[model samples]
Target: MIRILFTMIAIGALTSAQAQTIESGSHSTTGYIKSDGTIENSSHSTVGYIKNDGTIENRSHSTIGYIKSNGTIENSSHSTVGYVKSDGTVENSSHSTIGYIKNDGTVENSSHSTIGYARGVKKEWAAVVYFFFKF
Candidate 1:
């Protein structure tokens, strides 16, 4: 199963000149931004978000890495990018999702899911399943 690496909360807002506002643990409409108001780096445990003019990226788990808008979530060692939705869902990149995922170390930034697999999943989606075939 995937896990959280790091999470940092800064109780301040960065100016629009060099950065934007990032209210730690604020479940409001606006999320947090980096010092540049564009680029976001991992503080630890949660997600590092970038201001894309819409949809404030809440948090991701990664260590000593950077974030880009071209749909890329990078990590070093056991770091990962976590996902959170409006309906209260948390997804990580390390989870195999179903049974097709392994520790190949190539997970994408998907919502409430692991980047390894997306096959034979339930339509309703109750919980994360890990199936092992018996030979």
Candidate 2:
């Protein structure tokens, strides 16, 4: 009986480990995953969506949002789109020049905005929003 019990325990552990290995490769989650592979916060204050390779795609909050990548954004909260930078900055139509910082550490809002950073009269570096796609 003792041997049978040990076997069962070992089998359970092995199964769980095997499951984790499957997750380590190309993991994708529509919900949330704890550091221990346990699901948490299905839907609530922290309602978020993450992808495999530990990248967050879409995140929602009562007051703020955090997109952790420097890519094409089809839309934004204020009816705009943006991109990201390595310095966690976001460039959007709203902010125009000084793009905001994304939740992740990447520069953003460089897609449909200006491509210049200039100094203001106050001796502060400011973003100059101006760019023409030339149709």
Candidate 3:
């Protein structure tokens, strides 16, 4: 009986850990743009932040890049990496069409690959929200 209980507990723990990993990897949620320019997930977790100067920072508060007023996303070295167009489309710095934010908040990569999605608002609203909060 003791061995059985131990085995079950171990299994449960393993399963829980795996679930957390999966959740953290491709988690989708409605993020909010705080008054201070910090972005928080649906669960109120601080994923990153955007500074007034357009610097993007991760949860650890490390500067990653910047988002230009024109919607261009640049690296820390100020090189343009990607951009979000006014039409809700995302593209690489090379100007090649990458992907688009659909009417349902789905985000796809250049290959039409689903990186993740947004929740809570209409397509346009979601796009606008993401445009400011994107990291």
* Each prediction's TM-score versus the true structure: 0.24, 0.26, 0.54
Better of 1 and 3 by lDDT: 3
Give per-residue lDDT, candidate 3, residue 33: 51
Candidate 2, 49: how far from true, in Å? 0.9
Assess candidate 2 and give its TM-score to the true structure.
Answer: 0.26
Model 1 TM-score (2 dp)? 0.24
Residue 106, model 2: lDDT of 20
- What lDDT would each prediction earn against the true structure? 0.27, 0.30, 0.60
Error of 2 at 74 (Å): 2.5
lDDT of 2 by residue, 1-135 (tens): 999999999998876543111011123222233332222232422333323322233333132222333343332242334443344354554544445332321212345332222211000001111111000
- Candidate 3 pairs with clashing backbones: none
By summed lDDT, the worst window of 10 consecutive residues in model 1 runs over 126-135
Worst-scoring 10-residue span by lDDT in model 3: 16-25
Off by over 4 Å in 2: 1-46, 53-70, 76-80, 93-95, 98-135
lDDT of 3 by residue, 29-116 (tens): 4555554566666676777766777777888998877777887887778888777787778777787776777655576666777765
Off by over 4 Å in 3: 1-36, 40-44, 111-114, 120-135
List candidate 1 segments past 4 Å from native. Answer: 1-18, 25-63, 77-90, 95-135
Tell me how far the alpha carbon of residue 26 in candidate 2 is from the true structure, in angstroms, after superposition: 37
